[model samples]
Target chain A: MKPTTLRSFLPRPAINQRICISRVSRGYAVQAPGNPTLQVFNRNTKYLQKERAASNVERSRQADYLKDEVAMRLSERLLDINRHFNHVLDLGANSCNIARALTLPDPDIDPSKTTSPPLSTRISHLTAADSSRTLLYRDVDLPFNQEINLTRQVLDDEERLPFEAETFDAVLSSLSMHWINDLPSQLAQINHVLKPDSPFIAAMFGGDTLYELRTSLQLSDQERRGGVATHVSPLADVRDMGGLLQKAGFKMLTVDVDDIIVDFPDTFSLMRDLQAMGESNAVLGREPGGIQKDVLLANEGIYRELHGNEDGTLPATFRMIYMIGWKEGPNQAKPLPRGSGQINIKDILGGGEVK
Target chain B: MPTRISPIEKFAKAAAKCSVESSAYGKCIVVDYNSVHKDKCLTEFLRLKNCYLAAAKKP
Candidate 1:
């Protein structure tokens, strides 16, 4: 494969360049509310959390297992689609996990021989955008010999997308949408930005994610403090995903749920890992005080007692909801009209002749 | 049928009206983000939450 310069594929417009420069100089600002929109997660706090995680090189590296696993799984789904995307967008691309998954050769592939093409051969260019500048630039200098043309943009997922309509051939996100406040609107924005018939594939934390931790925290908090505060941010349910995508004007929707269980030595270790992963609770109006010492202790005991594994390891479930939707277009497949079939279903099923 | 407004959107709208309370609670948390415990800013948070609910009830 010949090396393609980023400039050769797409030229940067003067106006776009000026916008980028201005955005960089001003830093990211919260959306100026024209119409009243509800705020779910505090974007400023979330950005700070991600920035803190990115600053910790060691902890962040260890916490990347989850992102790496999810990224690979999402990429597999993308590869199943039999089309070459000329320009793809990786939305909420923290640490560029999707980019790494696409560009790097699989472990099974031999490095010496040029017999097999890299996975990224299907995409000619990738744009990685993240709300947190630090996380977006975390792996900027990583050496990938077969790297595809990539552009990094610091963008808040909550705000309106800066790109024009029907710009990207495909838009993919991994483990990001859960933090979005208005998910339906976000999905609509994604659908608007995709070229006709192009796919939007994403994986996010489902409602059942961290049930053990959530339950334990609630139980402990209720017992100790007489009331429970919002410790864990609410996530989207698998059942509602189809409706959301359809409401966003996406056709031919597919939603699947998967669970990844990770073993931690204790509850404290798990919580620390979550922080390192930039997955801390950012729910608005959440209890400001840290988890009380007594509550923490009680929560640990409750967590182990309720959900502990046999070998003394605590199991934490990360429920992932994967969804695929395509923008409507003339070239896409269409189902037949109602009652269009000529053959009777009874004959096919060998059930007797129709009266 | 008209689309029903989601509970999240309702809560968010209410929260938007209580920006002062919300920011006060948020500031308390940010001040001691790493070492925050239960009930550290309970008063501020509860005030914000109450304001949110109250605001949400109107219309």
Candidate 2:
């Protein structure tokens, strides 16, 4: 967090911006022939589509509290920037939760605590894009007129955004980036479409997400089958995301973590909730044939014993990593050139003399 | 213009270069198919990758 670190860590805006442009001159170079090694996420679009379909069905039956929470929180953070966006794109806009949050503030929800202006006032147009065809058509039931503000809902994959360069003024993604197979390259795609100095804010589950469930499942599999299988998809660590943003040619970057712990009656209900949320284990390396009955039961016991609360409910932790990065531009802040500091750190710390 | 490959395909291609004979565990890449499920995971991964490519081709 030191100034020196920031200077070294962040790419110089003006120079790096041009460099980024040249590097991505041809747009996303995803499939070079004979490369043979670019499988980042499971990239199982069938499973991904199925998961989104199931979540869409669940959304009709019950509200998605987690998605709504993330959307609202992201909205709050976007407003904190105090910049009005003429056009904003919501990537992986599952059911347009973030779009709704941006377009309309709930009437029933308390507004007394909200001091800043509503996001709707600032954004002239909003586009919600998602890979799930169902989510693209799903009813968000927004209070605002969709035609006026929520301009477009497109069904598209995040990995390859079909947009011209420097299109949007701002971009927001919630709880979706983690599923991307190649996040860095995809982030570069994001960087490509954004206008210079525009902000891109995203939130995804961190490495610590579902730690309790993962540990219990591992213990159960080990005790019952004498080996552990992949029950949870690997999550991105917060520490790693900062470097990714920088690598993607972003400036003035920030990454932080937020933890949400929900209590369930039992492991069964926890698993059900995960399914309903479209967050089931879809790792390609996962043990095939699914969890056996014995292992599942054992996992329940272990989960209850280890993470259960006094109220007979078990804890499920979700660590969300939030990141904000600005597309490099001349307007963005840049660190002073090295050896330009007037005050020496040693002088302040009462250390050695000037060299 | 050069043909633009999908990000997943690019990652899959990069993964092929790594012949560690075990899971490639990292922040960006985590392929446990070679380690745990062996050929099953790898086969399925290839099939899925092809599906992604085919799907990407349509419109």
Candidate 3:
């Protein structure tokens, strides 16, 4: 009862948040809904039809949430699965994965049932916005396009979002938000979006990803050269990421990390997947602009030598963390009426106090 | 024995976020919760989300 504080929850999302006012802005413009300046809204009518069809497919799709058995076990100890949310926001909801996995329209439950409300009935409206890799993907039906809205907009790390504070029921992100360099400020913006007692859920790759690649490059450089060698860009650690969440004011914080080994037959296959997914690291503070081929080749060689086995295929480890936190309400409350255990029925009977 | 947030209080918070300005209307009265959202109201409104998810998994 004492309005469960942040300590009671798991997977604090504030770790990945980064908010900052930008002196530099990128190519941006608003395309009118119809007469489009950009091609995103081109086939609005066609999109509506495709969206309708996609929803039919989504109704049956079982969302693949997590593969790690340990993460699944840890998550059971973390999330308050029964807590009902009203206003949910999907921050950087690429392909609408997490939203389909969670959210219910009729939160008030019948108690006997196991599943949430159906896709059509649950989740009042889910708004999924991301800077379009192609404006074409907006209506492009992939897998989980259900009753949701898509938009093309750049998220400012420092400034407040277009929406008001304490408005969303819950804000969720999966495999996104780490791109932000000013992660702390973004966490505050997430806090600003939720109403008191709301929750934020998120998942992101931890810093340990590509370590074999990083380490191999470092050792090779040390042996032949003096300086540290550049390899795969690193991710944030789970403990450091969690500290950022606490600083963002999210209570009941919890973070869980899962080590997933990814096998790549070759580097080109891995790079292609990264490009299609728009996952090339975009950290703003990197030294300079432009990529080189020789450096990349050397880096790959180093990574392979460190993590490869006799089979020749390379192994890359990806650590993913899922976090959550609550927007603290005024004055936490405790259940069972504070200290109601002091009274004794035997004392009342002996004193003849029965009415 | 406890503080139970009224259903209406909880619902209004959920409903108010979906209330947006009508694109067609002039600034006369921008907030358009009535006509624009009426048909798809259940789609974004909590009154329907619970039903869809709870039944989605059932055989």
lDDT of 1 by residue, A194-251 (tens): 9999999999999889998998788667655767888888888999999999999999
Ranking 1 against 3 by DockQ, winner = 1
Q: CA lDDT of A71 in candidate 1? A: 93
lDDT of 3 by residue, B1-59 (tens): 87775433343233222222111111111133122222222222232234323333343
Local accuracy of candidate 2 as per-residue lDDT tens digits, A275-324: 66666677777766667754554455456556668886778898989999
Please list the residue runs of candidate 1 whose C-alpha ends up more than 4 Å from where it truly belongs after superposition: A1-36, A106-115, A339-355, B1-59
TM-score of the first chain alone, every candidate:
0.84, 0.80, 0.61
Best by TM-score: 1
Which lDDT tens digits does candidate 3 get at residues A1-355?
5675776476746533332223134246666564222121122322232233234333213222232232233223324455544445667655454444432233344579776453323345555554332322433465335443333343332123677877787776666565545567778888888888766777777778767655644543442333443435556688887898888988777687767777875444454444444444343333343233323333344444445556867786767777877778776432466668887868867967558
Please count the clashing residue pairs in each candidate, in the order shown: 8, 17, 50
Look at candidate 3 and tell me the lDDT of residue A262: 71
Q: After superposition, how far is residue A13 of candidate 2 from its true place, in Å?
A: 63
RMSD of 2: 18.6
